[model samples]
Target: MLMVTLLSIACCCGCPAYFGKPMWEQYPATASLPAQVADLSLRTDARSENTIRELRTDVQNAHLLADDTFAGVYATRQGKTATVFGTTGFHLTPESDAEDELTRLTSKYDLGEQQVVETDVRGEHQRCAVGRSDGVDVVVCTWADHGSLASGVFTRLSLADSATLLGTLRKHIVSRD
Candidate 1:
């Protein structure tokens, strides 16, 4: 639901970027789940794999940016599993760009009644919500900087735990080059 037309305008007219960052830059991002993240192991089962595949297609079809990269992971620890799907793309409005993705994620999972979480992302804008998924209490967190957007589904975990884990995961999964 976003476009990259302003980059051309800025380049043509020599417009200054926000906080010295150019709108045309792609942020050079990469996402992955390591073998362990705060005790969560990377999931590679058929169901997890299929879910990630379908979700990645959704991200691609969203047409969020002119140039985008998508990544997803399902990790399990102590019998609790979570899925995180994310993309890195350039958008004129980084602050609210991820909100659409968050809404799409919650609706896709049939979530109801979300509570916003106040987690910070390097002083960038982030929105998080907690809800029930498949009768399991869970939290979904979304974060966006000038470069990237992501949301996660944490099953059988409290909001605090999900937020903390998501923060940690974002640190590892998303990075600038």
Candidate 2:
């Protein structure tokens, strides 16, 4: 019994060391892009009552901005009357200053009531803010991890819902390899 217990403990502790860093840590592409569109969890359901009507991926445009960037937009509909748009992007900039970017966005959009929050995203830090732009409610979430930056802008959803959705979407941008 003693030998068996010791062996189990050794194996448990050795596994992680043998595996090295996670895939996200080792590759910028994996860490910066979502594995799939469905991973964003932006779909209609009985509870959400929101059906995705259109999905667009702009890989070429994203590549124009940066060699390692992924961008997408989703348009969702509610019944026949309401439509909402959400956009997400992962940009890899070796010298990105997350704070400066946040400041620029806040200034351009006139964001209000900004709050710094902890995020599951593998980043140095995350910031979230809510505001109104052109008579529409908007939520912006930004985070920087190493040289990669991730951000999401959500509209037509409640502030609380926007935050929740942004968080869920950010969590899905993981290393698939």
Candidate 3:
């Protein structure tokens, strides 16, 4: 049932219509997080209403993916032999508790201090952090300027698609910034 719901959600917006049809298969290797040190970002407070308004308009320029599962829209960038993933926040009711848990776990992991920075998106403030586990690189960022919402995207650079995504994200951020 959960799979059905997820699939249904994945088949909407700009996602490939074929994603919901037959022959739907995910690459096994890409199905899970890579063997790397996982890093998480810090918790953020809500943004001002003006900031939210600005972010809403600015985010439209982001490089949005058609089949993104985390956020209906996401922006990608290239990283050091890896990829950087960016997306709109997940603010489901349950996600509130989840964010708190993530914050605690992130502190325990000593993933470095969460650095608050202004995102390329207007008015959005991002708390960015990076960590690694095994051989894979992990980055966790939360954009909380969009009200009671947070956007986060996890990325692995080992996959070819990830590499491509990283490059795109890098290009967009660098040029836009």
Predict model 3's lDDT versus the native: 0.35
Number of the top TM-score candidate: 1
For candidate 2, the 10 contiguous residues with the lowest summed lDDT are 79-88
Best by lDDT: 1
TM-score to native of every candidate shown:
0.75, 0.51, 0.29
Could you tell which candidate, 2 or 3, scores higher by lDDT? 2
- Pitting candidate 1 against candidate 2, the one with the higher TM-score is 1
Off by over 4 Å in 1: 1-18, 21-26, 64-68, 112-116, 119-123
Per-residue accuracy of model 2 over 1-177 as CA lDDT, tens digit each:
999999898898877655434323624444343434432423344433422222113323322443344444444443211222222234334124455455656864578766766654443455667765667667766655443455566776655565566555555653433
TM-score of 3: 0.29
Model 2's alpha-carbon lDDT is 0.48
The global C-alpha lDDT for each of the candidates, from Candidate 1 onward, is 0.68, 0.48, 0.35
Q: RMSD of model 2, in Å?
A: 9.4
Candidate 2 residue runs with Cα over 4 Å from true position? 1-27, 31-67, 79-96, 120-124, 174-177
Can you list the residue pairs that collide in candidate 1? none
Tell me the TM-score of model 1.
0.75
Expressed as tens digits, the lDDT of each residue in 65-176 for candidate 1 is: 5355554555554678768877776655655666766777777566655555565433355666767777777778777665677778887787778877777888878767
All candidates in order of lDDT, best leading: 1, 2, 3
Q: Model 3, residue 137: what's the lDDT?
A: 58
